[model samples]
Target chain A: MIRICIFMMILLATYSCNDVLDVPSQSDEDIVLELWNHIDRNYCFFELKGINWDSIKTASLARLNVSTSESDLFEICGDMVLALEDGHAFLRNGQTNIVYDFKEGYDVHFDPIIVEKKYLNSSFQREGIYTYGMINDSIGYVYLYGFQNRELFENIKGYFKQRNPQKLIIDVRNNGGGDSALSLEIVEYLIDEETKVGYISVKNGEERDDFTEVANVVATLSSNNYPVKTNILINRGSYSASSYLAGMVKYIDNINVIGQITGGGGGGGQSFELPNGWVVRIPHHYFLDAKMNHIELGVEPDVEIENTELDIMNQRDLMLEMAIEY
Target chain B: MIKFDLDTYRLRFSLTPIKHGVTGLMLMISASVFSQSNKTMFFKAGFVQQSTFENRLTSNYRGGVGLNLELGFEKTSEKYVSRFSLDYSKANQGKSYISYSTIYKVDLKYENLKRIHTIKGLYIGGYIDVGTMINEKNGLWGSTNNPISFTQWASLGMVAQYSVKFKNDYLWNMSLSTPIVSYIIRPSYGSVWPDKFLEPQNFNLYERGIVTAGLKSGNVALFNNFSNTIIKTSMYFPFKNSQWHYGLEYSFNRIHTNEIKPLKQFANTISISFKRL
Candidate 1:
């Protein structure tokens, strides 16, 4: 009885919704369906994805081998995730940042240069997030510590546009996450308007790829027709729209994502109070890159640099140096 | 104790950051910034007698001291009680068979009840501690010639305790104490073999300074002799003004060595401490 109570308490502590209390009643399929309904209603862009989710879910679930392990369920769930074909769409557990980069047959591999980064700061310290600094005089650096306001976007774009530096290094090494629209708004100056950044697809167990879309970078700069030379510095820690911004920029080719690759795809986190009142964030949506490639493998880095104790001792900004030299 | 004694002597002094408007300050003259009100601080000094059930034959009795600090916060209202505290303790036992341990604990506790002896006095609280231990002088006999080794290790644990206060004043205070349950993991002795030996590292600026001064003063002998034990000895030093709080307290402790199934035995000790709380 004590163990059961402990288990229930833990389950309650971990689950974020009233429906989560009914998790025991629902099979894996029912849970997936429930998540799909929740995301379809709440995702920032559900209807725009434009895919038939039910058929996609049917196709994806049909591929499952009916295994009774957590991994098998994850694999089945992962296979279901691919139906969206939008690189930004994915499902992930918190265990490992490295997921099967679905583009490569969803093969298990190390988190891409991008996806391993989620560790810059476990709790992204909410200090001065929009603080701007200059590195090597050539790179205009604006560290988006937290993505809170449009003013941060305005600060970066305005700084870059006014200075018109030859190369701009937007340091997103520490950005945990924020608004995707805010990120997409910043991408406007870097990419041409007609350029299709990538697609975002959502899937349920039976409703596979219910939503799909080809989102265009709506940043005011390029939408207003100003393409600036940009290089966004990403560490393993960047996530959410920040990771999306990196992948979207990677597809455009004009923007070189420097530094180590990111800890690829992150699930769209939903905040909910567990039955025990412990606030939790559960990731519900998985994202991919423009080529229907899942970045859960993380976006690859143009240059790979490791942070070592020796580097800190010597006071080296290896990423900035690599970007400047490149 | 694996302390980080910095090279400089630094003192931290904090002043209230909250500002009161002129009208607010004038309206409440008694609640001035420098209210001589009681911001309660409790320092517990006690000792324990520890025995090893597994290694009784080889180990001897141990007597060591423990100190804990409790810092109170401004009450939000008369109905609610909240406080944040940093708890630390150090204990040492035996002459050649010393065990030293230290813990840095931070916890936010809330009192569910205000009145004493009532059912509402049933309080629940929890605290988390990250600490380190060092042990010297192992084996059944107090022989320095044994193939003993000193260990430096860290541990993490949580504590839940319940108590009802009889007298809540700084002096003449009394309370019945009982721990709900506290879980601690002491890493297996001799786990790190030849390649990975334990060495002490500075944990903070103050400890770094102490270490540097000790080293400069040629006090390597102090550490070299008592290097093998797992408990922290610095916390057990019988000094009344050892920490920030002024209090009087007492405790009992028991510690023992880890050995083979038969040879090792237990070490026990008891201590009584009186200080400003």
Candidate 2:
């Protein structure tokens, strides 16, 4: 009995000795290292962009010191992540917000005023996230400003049913992306058969290349198959889900993309908090076009056309005009 | 008969060897007939205070004050003892995140009792325990409302217990169980939310119901990537001719895995029990 009791005591003592809760207290340097390591492991565009993440870490660390305030540290961290050149990567502190400087730097190729007055014959109707009308009594025009409102797709389908125009123009030039699902919902109305839209791969492990097997993202054609000649207008300001839409439309037969290259952000964002309570949003999945091309560098237009200052001065949207002519 | 002194004869008759043998025989017979093998049924209710930490849900360990209720039955024979119990607990944790969890558990145990030397009221035993636990947790944000976040474990383990009977049939028992094999079910990482099953396009009336939703989340697993340990101690004081007992109990359990996060739970309770034999 004494021997058995002693053995049981030893077994209990040794059972979970290694299971210690060791959440380390973070110093400023430790926070930087953690942030760097987080990006090194989880960020999806590192390989595609050919960025040396280690050099970014070293450069950021050189700028840090004991006298650096919390906000300064936040900025340094944000700058380190912005080096990835992905618009989906972002960080925010109390007074500072960091995002890829895409909008202010790119030239404005789309003017809503010109599009409203000249293209739609000064008759623009707004329904949810969609602005639609008939251009010259021949082309159906729908300008999607965002992808959040799903009901707009159904409404556009109804409008197309009523008009039955020979050509359709979809102006998504400055449509900063929202939901990818809603983008597919819009594509379903135009496609006539099951289409392999693209592929999506996610991080399955902590390693950089520890990605899951790529899965084909298919968009099934909806019952409303309005097979008019479709022209999608894209520009350097078209981003995220809008860029994804550009990639999808390239596979459909009746669609032709016009204008400048899209501003690409082809991954989904996931948010994580730092030790000091600031949030960092990183892209964790890679979206590939049907040709297995990484769309992180933006999709090119089928017939590249740039809007000039003269075109804007004359109240002409050249891209919309091209779509109308096509 | 022979001319003997009356006092001496009386002493001899009182001290006879045969008379003492007959008395010893009768006591042995009565003891053999009325053995201490019986069955007992008990119901218990108590206030419980619990603390839990689940890293998948939150980073901090949260404490809650709640109620614990239990019903149990035990059968004891000369060689072994069998026990079955049903227990339920509900608690709310945290103030900001505000997590709430309810757990229902059922356990059946069989122990082979062994007598100990040098301790008159003590017994040492090895037990086989089979139990199932279902726990649901939800909070203010994230995937709390999703059914996939709920946890269910079907466990089989070996237990070691030391039980002591004190004066007037009072009892003290301490047990420790480490699950050698467990089947665990949890949500997959970055998958569709469980509410997708409740949507109109994919809805089934039976599966979308509240009760069935909780049950369907349980997936079978066998000794792969999951482990747990449970320790419980209790004291019972008999009253009213040993027909009723009052108990105080404390239990601690920790479960962890590489796939999901680790969870630790502690419960302290005081209960009233009734025993039927």
- On DockQ, the candidate that comes out on top is 2
Worst 10 residues of 2 chain B by lDDT: B3-12
Q: What are the per-model C-alpha RMSD values against the true structure?
A: 22.2, 19.8
Docking class of 2: incorrect
Model 1 TM-score is 0.34
As a whole number from 0 to 100, the lDDT of residue A95 in candidate 2 is 51
lDDT of each: 0.38, 0.63
Candidate 1 regions off by >4 Å?
Answer: A1-127, A204-226, A272-280, B1-277
Model 2, B138-226: lDDT tens digits are 43221211212344566655555677778857788776666555655543332222222222222222213333443454444433345
Q: What is the lDDT of residue B219 in candidate 2?
A: 49
Off by over 4 Å in 2: A1-20, A103-105, A121-127, A136-138, A162-166, A224-227, A308-314, B1-224, B228-253, B260-277
- lDDT (C-alpha) at residue B100 in model 1: 20
Tell the DockQ for candidate 2. Answer: 0.02
Error of 2 at B4 (Å): 99
Q: Write the per-residue lDDT of candidate 1 for residues A152-212, one digit (tens) a residue.
A: 5655565556655666666677565555545555666666554545543322222333332
